[model samples]
Target: MRDTAKAFGEGPAASIYAGFADLVSIGTCIAEWHAAVVAATSDADRFLRAAKEKASIWLKEYAGREHLLALGEIAANVSSVSTSDDGKAVLSKLAKQPLPLGIFASHPKERPIFDGDHRSVGKEKPKLAVAFVEFTIDGRPVADIQHMAPNVTHDLELHIRISRWPEKAERLVLTPLSVESATLYQLPTFKVSAPSGDPPFTFSVRERAVFSVPQSFFSRPLEFKYGAEFQPLSVEQPVEVVGQRTLRLESVDWQRNPQTGYANIDQRILRIRDELRRWPTVSQDERAICLKLLVNLAKHVGQAVQDNVFPGVWSEGQFQIEVRKALRNDPSIGSALQEHPRSAGGIGDLMFQGVPIELKVETNRTLALEDCKKFIKQTTSYAVGNGKRIGILCVLDTSPKVNPPFPMEEGIGILFREADGYVLPVVTILIQGNLTPPSHFSR
Candidate 1:
């Protein structure tokens, strides 16, 4: 294991050091290797003598191999400092707009968002693609990037969010709530300057990887580009990713979970639950229909997963992706809701009027008792203390075997909170996907 660890780490460790040579050797960037050589450039004889001393000891201790290898690294390091720099012919100084250290000297000619929206297998999280273009419309710190859309071609801005927050963090992150598909874009860019006396600082990563026919694309970092803040350049089209899920759909069986008789005072809740199950809800049934739609919408997701009818593949996108699609695209659930605006916290998955719906996809065999307790706490906090009598919580426990008739188990979740020594009610119908094979699947 020790040898294996070193073997794996050395290649990347070496590449990182090697890639360092190009960026800083010309002093465009300040790196450790560049600093060492820069501090001694005025005294070449002294540097050569020092190198000779180390070379003698290295050669004696490990034959010529280690000595030659170290020399190669050092030589690469020195070659960079002695070669062409990125900005040798500096632009003549001029009256500059006071700006921050993060901006560049000129618009970095536009490029694609790259592999901005890909999620690889065995990763902790997907790289949520974010594109930043500086703009200050009406000179008010806020910029309505939305008004300027019709963005780059084939560029899918599934989530569109423009931010106007103060610069407070290492960086700012903005999220667009609506997920829509469009190909072209006319994004904006604003002009800003770097602070006085500092070399233009642009930390850019330009990478290209080839994914052969059967090999999946690797996870790529969030697209970070810099240009005139108000002059949002035309970004390169997003790289369309294709993938395949490894989970086999042996079969699925959808059976509605049985519910016991409800207490007399809670008949309304029971009726709402029953109405949602059998769709084509009556015109007079005025009870909050969002929850009903969510429950019914979730059915398409179960069937989709059971039959392998999804478009994108995720070694990770299996359950969550499919379920979110159902909640958003299903006509019964999405169209029936009054306001589909999304909210964080307990507003649930797809909210109707303001009720939150939480989607829990458990790898566990079923939506266990513990899952019920966990969902109750989450939905309660999301309800913000009001007796939000209509929130929904859905659970999917994916299975290995395929049931020809995919199953959907529905139940009631009682979210009780003690307020001044009295219990509060946050109730809803719970959908559980008891997916995994009943008999453990072994290779």
Candidate 2:
């Protein structure tokens, strides 16, 4: 027999790194990676170099890699030097914006909130105010609009005011929240005076300082383009009359783990748990339903493993059948539709309240992370086809050499995916199969 201690660190470490890289690209571990990188050092230059290198590598692999690479390039070339106190204040303000360095100057303009057909007349426009019905922290709701962390519960009361109320406004459906950062130049061109000397000279300087501002105040509310639903108010007040809402917003930054000096999964989860509430659209009940499904699935997974239910080779169909059976047996989930045909092309493995559920059984000796991502995308397509805007992907891991089993809490996650111009939240559940009994392994 070989020394177990010596064997611990051996085998496919590179593959594991690649797997995590894939996860980060898909926004599965973005908050963790971002927090890690930001907290790694206080020197901005070091941060830029490391971020640039990583972004450069990721851009080649992930087609939908966000603006990090381009932003890195812009930030690297430009040196932020403040000659005056005003300039220092500008730099301080820029640091708070989502994209501190600003997106590329040549990047295409952002899509307008209202199209030509939906434009408001003159100064008349719809006003929206969000009041938190239930928040994790007192008053202020965490706003991780990207959904990079764990569960986000939004219990909100949305107050909408407009010049004209909808004729058929029994039900109000609000959109998901999207983020936009705006960069403005203080001055286009200015005359610059040379340094004091016997013969002082002046010249023209066309470049001006750019200041980025997060659209959180008035221009940009946490409102998405589509999907999240809201109910209209039942008050007897007139359409034009609306109550005022005041919220004191505060941001939580840099919660690092004691040992790692980086934010862990739980910390990231806690920091953003109440984020959805700020959007004013996501209902607490809807989130509770999804959470219930996930929690129950997790419990069933643990119990099934304990019972040694999955031990041999199983096909995707076989796995789906068994999973559906398990869910059906549970009194909570009475039944679920199987192999449900969608309006767009292929069929989904399961359907619950129109939400697509795609099941996969991995038979390979080594599970590739790319394959995992493909499994998610498959479910996302189904959800988009069915017009659910949400999906559940259950990947049953049955590899023989499965080491370092996925964590119960960390194993389950919700990641955002863009489909047909809308951001869809996809919940991923990893179900491990063919596990050795706990008594069989030495501590």
Best model number under lDDT: 2
lDDT of each: 0.34, 0.44
Instruction: Give one digit per residue, the lDDT tens place, for model 1 in 369-400.
Output: 33566666666555443335334555554433
Residue 3's lDDT in candidate 2: 24
lDDT of 1 at 395: 55
Please identify model 1 stretches exceeding 4 Å from their true place.
Answer: 1-286, 294-320, 330-348, 385-387, 399-443
Error of 2 at 207 (Å): 57
